[model samples]
Target chain A: MEYKVQVIVKPLDAIANPEGKAVERALAALSFDRVTKVRAGKVINFTLEADHPEKARSITEEICQKLLVNPVMEYSEIQISQSGN
Target chain B: MDPIIKIVTFPGTNCEYDVLKQLNFLGADAELIWHQESDLGSCSGIVLPGGFAHGDYLRPGAIARFSPIMEQVIKFAESGGPVIGICNGFQVLTECGLLPGALSKNDRMRFICKTVSCVVKTSGSVLTSAAVAGQTLHLPINHGEGNYVCDEETLKYLRENNLAVLTYTEDVNGSVEQIAGISNKAGNVVGLMPHPERATDPLLGSTDGQVLLRSFIEASK
Candidate 1:
């Protein structure tokens, strides 16, 4: 089975988010007063081939721990779904 | 024979020549090693020079850390060889777990390019052995993601172990505790955002960088 994996990695809340702050300032300049908090993150999309969705997800989780995310500064969430679903 | 230093160059790396020139001027044999190669070619020391590797895609060093050459670099560092990562090289070091902490985006989201004052916080690492603990050096820094950050526990460990080699005299990028450079526990691997190679000439406004680079060259011998 082919699964589509989407990994979203964001800096920990304790870490500074300058890109997010820049977006917020831009919104404020455009008169969007209600938009208060903005955070920036990275979304990585890839395809995983496995016999089962559970196996694909497990492999992705391992990769996330090893590479896609730095535990010291970022947190990650992985989403997996059947391809073309 | 002069000890050869290998300056590893990724696809997007730009400072390898600068590093090569400086080390050559200091009477060391230095050459660029491509990222795909598994062999280090008899180099005694390794340098990961500055620049946006892999176009700084997926974060600065995230992509470069997976290069085949990195595996060799890691092996060399583990074997107690001297490895220094400057600027984006520092990002690669942290990404590959050679050093502690991550270099986050600058607090103001600006690409800082200027000479900054840094003080040698410790004299134990390969890069700082020629420096006194209280000695200051002026070096050029050019990066957007140079603000080094780590948890309190890691910071405490670095301080207690004398791994924090250099600290900015003033907050240059909002790095934790003003850290400008740090080394691994073994003091064989060191990384910093400032460009010591760019500061080697008096005509360049400072030669303070000689102390650090000289220390590295000597250690590799």
Candidate 2:
């Protein structure tokens, strides 16, 4: 099975996001036109052999908790896909 | 009893020797302490040096804070023994819950390296005991995650209690209140982004940082 994880690393609610603010500024300057908010994040994709979809999700979740993202400022969204056999 | 300080070393820390050297030059016996050690029985104070611990894998100081030695550090601070965190160590202190708030990435989105002026907003901390209100000193700071952030109410409280130890003279980073360093309420623990030990010699063209180390010496006695 192959999995794709999109990690959304943003400042906490109480924290300020200057990176996002800068991107927003650039968006307005470059005239991307309708872009209102610009936030940056990371996307990770990997392949793993698993018994089932639930098992894959569990293992990936553990990786996310341990290393895939920093819970303090980032959150991870995982998607699993089966390869053509 | 002469005071002995221990400089805690995480896997990626580069400044333990710098801290040990400076403290030793100041007439204190300083030793390197490995991160896995649990007992802190031999020292009067502990220093967490600056560097990219755990290769800054997750976040600066995020994984480093959970090491076994930090358990002892928290206990030592709770017992009122002084702890000083510099640069990356400061990030660890905040991550380990020994200090309030966190060091976000620089608002400028760049790593800033230079001597910036810091004003002494509070003078009673062990780290700033030699300073006076409104006094300014030039210190070198090098880091991307040097922005200090706290909740609005907490920020107000820190200001009220004069816990802001070092504040930048101008907005170099997007740090709230331009905070360069801060101390806990009890004032026994301090964490700062600048490298004071790096500035403590005349050969370095700035000895204004000597007072900070001098203040630590005075506190241990």
Candidate 3:
């Protein structure tokens, strides 16, 4: 199966996400949420063409470590689904 | 007195000359050591000059941290030798685990290049002996990944240990606690984001950078 992987690099801005924090507080106040943590992050959307799921994940990891992300302040998560064969 | 300080020059790093010139001006011998070489001369001090090392490809200093000379550099620092890393060199030191925290992209995602005022906080470091707290000095910073980040608890320990060396007088990057520089726990390793060698001359704006080098000179002896 083919997959699409996205990685984002973002700074931990102290005051840059006050709006997000306010919303999070509202969610907890309303008592309709099981949300625990929230952070404003950038999204990098792209398609990855690989042979198999194992190959896809390894490739995604390599790309993240190499070019797709700056490991300093950014963490990456890889999502794999059938995109194309 | 040991004449020459060994300056590590990683591939793609371009600031060795400025460091060499600055040291030479201070009448201290300095030489550019290659990244691919394992030999670190018998010099008592080491300077990791600023520049784009390894094209800054795999993160700012990620790739360069594993370079051959870095192995030698680590050993030098292990022996309690004075080691100073400027700008990109700071990133490398952090990535190599010689220092704590990390320098990420500037808060604005910009490569900021300008002379900004900085205050010396730590007094006994090899890089800040003459610079007392609140001593303002102008230095140029040109890097995209210059914002310093560390956890609050770790930052507290750094402060308690007098490891946080410099802080920007104005917010140039999104560094936590306004930290512009830091030293290792042992206090022998110094890492800073600004280019002090660029400010070593009055013609450039200020000779305030000379004192940092002077401290290294005295401490190495």
For candidate 1, the TM-score is: 0.96
Which lDDT tens digits does candidate 1 get at residues A7-84?
999989999899999999999999996898799999999999999988998999999987788887899998998998
Model 1 residue runs over 4 Å out of place are none
| Tens digit of per-residue lDDT, candidate 2, span B106-181 | 8867899998999988888889998887998999999998988777777888988889999999998889989999
Model 2 quality (TM-score): 0.83
After superposition, which runs of candidate 3 have C-alpha atoms over 4 Å from their true positions?
A1-72, A78-85, B1-3
User: What range of 10 consecutive residues in model 2 chain B has the weakest lDDT sum?
Assistant: B212-221
Report the Cα lDDT for residue B163, model 1. Answer: 88
CA RMSD of all predictions: 1.3, 3.8, 6.7
How much is the lDDT of residue A55 in candidate 2?
86
Candidate 2 residue pairs that clash: none
For model 3, residues B125-205, the per-residue Cα lDDT tens digits are 889986787688888888887888877777888978988888998788888888899998777899999888988877998
Candidate 1 or 3, higher DockQ?
1
Error of 2 at A28 (Å): 8.0
| True lDDT of residue A73, candidate 3 | 57
lDDT of 3 at B64: 92
DockQ for every prediction shown: 0.81, 0.30, 0.15
